[model samples]
Target: MFGDLMGMMGKLKETQAKVEETKKRLDTVLIDEKSNDGLLKITLTANREIKSIEVDDSLLEDKEQLEDYLILTLNKAIEKATNVHESEIAAVAKDGMPNIPGMDMFK
Candidate 1:
């Protein structure tokens, strides 16, 4: 019936609004990653914005050590950002299509 179709459409619109809200909230989530040695660290948001970088003073004495730690820390941060981004995207997709199973229909 037409009425039933309209009702489903309204529900879909509500779900879409929820998905948008989730995406907006994700912009506030921050994820941090650091090296095991604690000599280097990076901070990022779910949106993959580089918020900060930290390096230990002792490592400054050795350029190579500093460079290695920086690279490691940067990689870690990127990994963390990627994870957070995936989770946020998943949440939005789930909200948009809770009734559909095994459907990869969103970005």
Candidate 2:
């Protein structure tokens, strides 16, 4: 009936708003990563925006070592951020999803 359709539409709108809010919240969620020896450190938001980088004095002496440290540390930080981002968005989307009859099969 048209009533059910209208209710579903309203629910969808509410869900969308929640999802957007969750995304904004994720901007403050930070993920930190460091090199094995503590020579390099990285911090990024769940949205994958770099927040800071800390490098030890020893790392500056060797360009290649610094590059390697950057590559590894940045990669690890990005991976963690990606995981956080995906899980958060998925949670929001799944929670917001309307329970249509056939949709249960996808779960």
lDDT of each: 0.76, 0.90
lDDT of 1 by residue, 29-54 (tens): 88788889777778878777888888
lDDT string for model 2 (1-107, tens) is 89988888888898899889988999999999999999899999999999999999999999999999999999999999999998888887777777888776425
Off by over 4 Å in 2: 104-106
Best-fitting candidate, measured by TM-score?
A: 2
C-alpha positional error of residue 25 in candidate 2 after TM-score superposition, expressed in Å = 0.8
- Give candidate 1 misplaced runs (Cα > 4 Å): 1-20, 98-107
- The local lDDT score (0 to 100) that residue 86 gets in candidate 2 is 86
TM-score of 2: 0.89
